[model samples]
Target chain A: MCAMTSAQRVFTTLSHQEPDRVPLALNLVLRGARELGLSIRDYFSDPANVVEAQLRLQQRFRSDVLFGFFHAALEYEAWGGEVVFTEDGPPNSGAPVLGSHQPLSSLRLPELAASKGLLKVLQAIEAMKARVGDEVPILGVAVSPYSLPVLQLGFDRYIELLLGDRAEFWTLMEQNIAFCQSWANAQLAAGASAIVYFDPLASPTLVPRSLYQDTGFQVAQRTFAGLKGPTVTLLASGRSLGVLDDLAATGTLGVGVSCDEDLAQIKAACRGRLCVIGNLNGLAMVDWSPAEAERQVKAALAQAGPGGGFILCDTHGEIPWWVPDDTLMALGEAVQTWGRYPLVGAEAHA
Target chain B: MEARTLRFEAALLSMDRVLCRSLLQEAMGEERQLEGIEHLLGPALAHIGDRWEAGELALTQVYMGGRICEDLLADLCPTSSTPVAGGPRIGVGVLLDQHQLGKRIVASSLRSCGFQVLDYGQGLEPLELARLARKDQVPILMVSVLMLNSALRLRELREALGEGPERPRLVVGGAPFRFNPRLWQEVGADAVGQTGVDAVAIAQRLLEESCAP
Candidate 1:
């Protein structure tokens, strides 16, 4: 095969066909903030700074995808929720909208153009697209309708409502789907090539496998189905094994698993069905030497790369601010170096 | 694990504070809240945590369980005039973890177990822990380490805790401690516990050791 653009390589790999090399999609948020002398607070405040930092990281690493920037509290803030901003970390959803007994119909997906925090995100998407055009695929980030509730209503509180008040819970899910549709449309219109939706609640650590399939899957399926571009879903670091088939059932083109999952099993499960994009232990990438991190990436590639349909990325959606730039760069280098397809005879490949 | 306990667990799962308090009162009949916790509530909460881990329950359910335990402890724990043998004045809080529901449960359980636990809240810096220990003259300091940031700062926290004849004994617990049993030792802690009951046992022993003539 001839040389491929990162987009083509990603497209090819997701199709269960080998490209010249494996594709890489790095989710840079706090990791980039630290490098640019921008605090998490500063990063959330400026669209230009975010795009500039993204381009700098892209130029340095030449990764295949730039997972879009998110302010973490955008939706909560959009819903008039108070977000607690700290100098050292991401903002916390201080007071949940549903902190008290708010009726389910009270939830609203307001016009993005009317909301400042969310509007900034839409503008940032446009900025990244205007700057990087076709250089790399930009993945507009959207919290899955299921996972997004944890922001507006705290995780524990929301789950309480779900279990205790089924009527209100479904209403909340309906609101989420409605919100996601418009939010994703804004991103798609702003030039995001794809939507990377994250819904950690579907993972085994939060909801039962049966519960996720029955409720979480439906919420996600509708949310992903409405997306204007290709979709990739992220599962938080939890017991996700029980829900793989359910995840595949959502009809996302690809799935992002945590670093803790076994790759071989996911590949077998996703075989010729879904693109498998992960399992590089985020901690190992943060703590290990570059060479060790590279080896770890190669090890993940050996299992996830062979038959194609794999992308190299940190299993965690966010890397620690302390994770070194060299370590981040090393991931791209390893994929380009050792992630070639058509695995040779065992001894030679090793 | 009993049907009665299961009923309590179910009520707690739905965030029913009234029913939970009633069930807890029944379970505690004539026993210390610590005893009830160790025997009844603790196991129930642990089971909820298991379900949460197994995907049978949500983290929200676990948090709601913690809240129910907290509300019950408000009535059940502080009223125990009959003090236990190992009761001591100790300071307790989580280090660097905003998820204080687990720590709150641990602190409440310790209070019921007869320790006078200082509620330092979560997001405590190592320096604050040292100051609280020294200022309060607490002989046994219990700090919960759950986040990686807290774990990384353990060595510094140990040094910041200072050295003196009245130096508080450091007893560690939480997932980070369970993740590495030897972590407490690395942080220069006197002991570590895998559970709230174990934490009380370890704290008592450490307190007794600190008081050794």
Candidate 2:
């Protein structure tokens, strides 16, 4: 097998084609930055720092794709929510603006392209693209419309509105979809080759499967359908596997699975259709030894990597301040060593 | 039958299904307040957390149910329940990087157990929280930091209180503390509550202990 660049390997795997080896992809975000010893606050506040962090992250993981923004708060921050910045932790909302039983009509949805922090994100994308457009696949991260509404109107209120009024909920989703389309289009125009929609809150662990399918999944489908770039929809919790087929049908290039889902099951469900990008236990990287990390990564590769359509990554973003550096590095090294393809026969097709 | 049994049944049912919708509705009020529900809201939530921790519920069930409870608490600001006359005001908030559920429940439990409770919500800066405690004239400040990193901020809150004679007694709790017992002293908290029931008892003990001198 010939040597291939990390970007070439990752995009090839994502495209369901053979690469030199299975790609080691880090879903780089604010949390991963802290794990990598960079400052999350500094990254967002300074454009130069953002550029440095992106390059360092790409170098460290030898990642196939480059993620532009770090957290999901930018969209909410742009949609009239006050983001409470932490010293080194992920930023959270100041206070929820929408109330229970509050009519969705009372809220004014902002135009996605004109939101504040979004421009900063777009600028980051432009900077990253300008810097590494030819070297890496610049993947822009966007919050799903269903999850965006949770950010705009606090999660509780958003879920209530979703459960109580379908028409109004979908209208809100339509607005969010419009925002995502414009936001994604802007990022793509700025040089993003693909987009990853992070929808952690939409997990079946948070909402019932029926509600997720009816509201979250549908909104996600519409949002992905509107995106111009190749898209990866990340279902961040394992509880969403029962609906993996529905998720796969959303027209995304692949479905990102969380650690809780059975790898074999997801591989089987996603076979012949969309590719599978993750399912490694992220918390294990925090507490496990390097040897243990390698062992687990090898096991995950054995289960999910043999085929051409798999990309290796954590089930979720790295937890800040807890995960050890060596464990993360071990994961990357393990993927490089053990994730090669052309398995000796019958198992190769699997 | 006993009230505990009834409470247990109500708690189990709430954890399983009933209370989530109403709680979500209550938290997300029609206009978006999401703050005041943490008083009685805490016990209701604790009952659910207890069930989950005790293996009576699955993680997914606990999360989905907990999200509903948290959503409700997040919507309502702390409101006085028949304002305690001459009762020492107690302010409750989560340390930076910590989610507010367990802290909110502790605050709610404190109120039901007869302490004057003020829920400051989640991810508060140590200095800001200390300032709020001083401004509110709270005699007891209950802090909850769920994440290990945030647990260190309790010490910051203590330093912010300084040598002031009016400093409120501090109580801390959460998962990080459960993992690291030494955090109670490391964070400089006067007392630490391991559970919601224990938190209420600690508040009562502190009130009595402070009144003795």
Candidate 3:
């Protein structure tokens, strides 16, 4: 078989067919800033820097996917939500938008065209699409409306409102889904291959299976129904074993699995239905030896690589800022050597 | 196995704060808020924590339960303005990661249990945390983290905080430690809490040990 381009490899893998190798979508965000000798604030200050850094990273690692996501707070920030950006990690919410003093019903939905942070993300996606064209897949991210409350109202408060006030909760969900659809569709229109439907709250790790079924699942079903393009529902390193069936039912093309889950079981469960994107421990990756990195990569490949429906990626979707550059190099190298089609370790998984 | 404890647990799981507060008031009889926390609320929260660990309960239950209890403590004991005398000075903060929900719950639980917990804020560096500990003269500092990288940084935090009889007892908690049972010790913590309720017990025991003559 001829060697495939990154886009071909990813699309083929999503179709459950073995390409030249498993596609890699390293969720490098702050790491990109570090590569260019720029502070995180400076790196994200201009959308051009985000594009340049991502292109440089793709060139250096020779990975399959390009991420157009910067941070989750950007979505909330677009709606006048206060966000704080630091040197070490991605930006985080500064304060709760729906505090007791500021009720959800009283708030007005901000216009999408006026959102600076979100527009910057769309601009980055457009630039990357202009640069890479169809040769590589660019992955965009849209926080699930069901879970965006965690970023908007704070996790603790969101849980209270979710469980205590059903009326207000659904009202918040209605507003969020509208914003989420617009944001996700804009990314797709901007030339992204797919948007990651980032929804950590739906994971059984955060909420009970019963509650998720009643709330997050239904909300996700509605949210996914309106999206114009394909999406991969990401649980952000949260355990998804208990909710795999529900995740498969969310109309997503793929589901990002946590490192804590059994990869083979996940593959068997999603077989012929949804592409399994990950299970690599981003946390452990910080301290991995090159040999250890290879071993871990092979183990994951052995577990889910046989069916050709897996995309190798970090569990949390985004790689940590503190993870050494050498470690990422080792991971890329390991994938190149062992991730080829007709994988030697297929028997172990089969 | 008391009926009130079980009922209180159920109320918290259901997030019925009115019923929860009434149950606590009934269970308390005429005792103080600390007594209710010790005899009723503590055990109920612990049972909820166990259920959560066993996958029988949701994280929302645990979190809301803590928040509800914090509010109840404020309402029930409106004049309990200070920490119990002779207790070890306690402080709480999130390490590197900005996820501060866990820290807030722990701090509130500790405060409800009559410990004056100094809030050191979130995303604090090791040096900044150490400086805060020194400036505040806090003896027992509880640190929470959601990410593994942040959890591992406890070693650097421990070093910066120093090693001596006077150094604060580092208490660690959060998802990573819960995932890896032995991670707390590996990260140089003196103790680890499985939940906000567990933080109360751990703080009490640490204080007892510190005050030993």
Using lDDT as the measure, which candidate wins? Answer: 3
Name model 3 segments beyond 4 Å from true: A98-100, A346-350, B1-11, B16-40, B50-56, B71-89, B95-98, B111-136, B146-163, B175-189
TM-score of chain B of 3: 0.90
**Chain A TM-scores, one per candidate?**
0.93, 0.90, 0.96
Segments in model 2 whose C-alpha atoms lie over 4 Å from true places: A15-18, A28-42, A46-48, A97-106, A236-238, A280-289, A318-324, A342-350, B1-92, B97-118, B127-213
DockQ of each: 0.31, 0.10, 0.39
Best by TM-score: 3
Ranking by DockQ: 3, 1, 2
Residue A111 error, candidate 3, Å: 2.4
Candidate 2: count of backbone clashes, pairs at least 3 residues apart or interchain: 20
Question: What is the C-alpha lDDT profile of model 1 across A1-350, one tens digit per residue?
Answer: 67887778888888888888888877776556766787778777887777888778776776787756675577777777777665544565555665457765666766787888888777888888887778678888777888887767655567667667877778878878888888887888888888877788888766767667778898887887777777878875555667778877888888887655678888888888888988776644546788877777777878778888988776756665556778877777877778766644211444
Better structure of 2 and 3 per DockQ: 3
- Please give the distance, in angstroms, between residue A91's alpha carbon in candidate 2 and its true position after superposition: 4.2
| lDDT value, candidate 3, whole model | 0.82
lDDT by residue (tens digit), candidate 2, B15-91: 53444445434444642331323333445545655654443433334434444443333333234433332245688
* Retained true contacts (fraction), each candidate: 0.33, 0.04, 0.33
Pairs with steric clashes in candidate 3: none
